[model samples]
Target: MRLSSLLFCLCVASFPVMAAGQGLQRSGPMRFLYDMGVSDTDTSDPTMRQQLLQLREAGINVLSLDGWDAAAFQKLLPTLKADPLFSRFKYVLKIHPHVSSNWAANPTQVCSDAANGVLPADTAQLLDGVAAFGKQNADYVVGYYTFDEPSNKGVNNGTTICWQYQQLVYQRLRSGDPDSTDRPVITANTLYPVAPEDIKNSVSPNAQDIVFVDQYSTDPAVQATEYKDWGNMLKKVVPVFPAFSNNITTCQDPMLRTQFRPAVQSGLNTAYGANQPAVAGIAYFAFYPGRTYAYDAQNCAPIFNSVVDDLQHDPIPVMTKIEPSLNLILSCPASSSTAPASSSTSSEPCQ
Candidate 1:
């Protein structure tokens, strides 16, 4: 076996096993998902498998793909299933109607169906096709992400519509396949200010299995608050996965690679790893090198290693010690469930 693979196995075997009351348990339980765009049909990319191997070694158990469709997943599954190491890692397939349309189609912009108040005609068809795909690949498939950030404008508009739409798709998948590995519905909402309760309740634990909150802010203070608040809210309802970003709008932003970058990563590992019973794990934003950002996988090596180190060394005690100060500096008034939805809008995806 490769040195990286051997080390990764050793690190995973060393993780502190927890009891039932500590957190919700699931198959192949892992806390970090590296969210990026990867195709199953890249026959020419010889280095693709190596990059994925390195990622798994660095403690990322989930591969959350952004621009992947049902057809791409269908083509890719066999490749992953054939490899023992790759097959061990989980997958989050982003579903859309057409492969080309998914390149820019934001889940928030999906219009609601007039009759049933759910996704529009095109999106509904997309969900059905995606669910059928999930049924065909139940063992290795983890979940499906239909929407990016519904709390923002262009999606649910702070209303419960997005959650309702999630239910429509989630229920269909579950009812379609009653097997244990068939439950897979995932959504990642922006955790700026706070995630609205209306949207949160729309897909309760009974409706959806996992929820992710993104923290793209450069300010560590904001990152801490987002993690704590959103983590607490979604703890019991579903396993919370905090999302991180390697590069903002510009990949060369000095702040991103310098002060702000370390702070953001540290804050994520600390707040999410704090003895919180709800936080299942954390996920990073776009890992696509030339596609999503100029930053390559090498740029993320330190961050990935740090995450593995934190998990291996045991961050609970350290996080517990720093919790009080973080709460003090980042504290805010209780979020009002009735607060007005922000007018800020974005037609683009939240990657």
Candidate 2:
């Protein structure tokens, strides 16, 4: 379980073609976030280790614990800290809001009234908890994200206030933690059939700091364009890490069930989408079957494997190389060109 025994396997054979001299640099490789929220498997189980190893082999670097509460996260920290495979991975810790307030769903809507205080009691408590958790386990914790798809409705109390809340929460989370002050606070955004400009403007500036817009489309051309537009707009201000689906997308075909499952279609879309050149990296969503809470890896393997394969073979145009002296592994991707050499893909494990 020691870090020295770790190895990162890349399946480059599955890729279409590699441009000469274009290699996925050890420090600049795409970072994937894998959701283990609704998954039936738990990190405490024996099978969890194997799962983590396979994900690593497939090029996934971050494991997201979305559904786990703060107490549960604290309990699992030691196990994640000790494991070698985990040592190779970063984590997105999802901390729930304090009691009497459903901030995860809509902090802006719930705390709109003045009596709720300028920042609200639950919001401050949430920040305190996150700061403490982050300070205690700063090594493995890369960033924190709790809200899911907050921009569903146009900018309203639900959406606009959420940004304000995010500003406060992010400020509080990084208050005393000087090391992780620049860490990303990511949230999922809505992607309807409306004009792309509308969707772009709807996203909050705070939310755009670590952009992750999810779009599940049947057409790769459309998906590619969407990725490009979104990437162009968001990349200027923040790093863009979009989510790719594993579900099928042929909505008009006859015998829909008889056709490829959603996951199969998603896998195809992923294959086409990854080659778009605009895509920086992707976070794989295992929840298929109409977004039902389930992690059917058997159904999702095709897309997951395809995206991982693409990342391994295709080296993205390096945005900024890692500078080793900063000692800021979690925040390196968003950091400037002065980053130190990366330890995740390099021989040294990220400290």
The TM-scores of all predictions, comma-separated, are 0.56, 0.58
RMSD of each: 14.3, 11.2
**In candidate 1, how many Å is residue 201 off?**
10
Single out the weakest 10-residue window by summed lDDT for candidate 2. Answer: 1-10
lDDT of 2: 0.41
Taking the tens digit of each residue's C-alpha lDDT, what string does model 2 give over 229-330? 444334211112222343245112121112222332343245344332222234444333342212233444434344444444433333233433323243
Show pairs that collide, candidate 1: 108-154, 108-155
**lDDT, candidate 1, 328-350, per-residue tens:** 21111222221111112221111
Clashes of 1: 2
Which regions of candidate 1 deviate over 4 angstroms?
Answer: 1-28, 40-46, 65-69, 83-85, 96-125, 154-161, 179-182, 194-207, 216-277, 286-301, 311-351
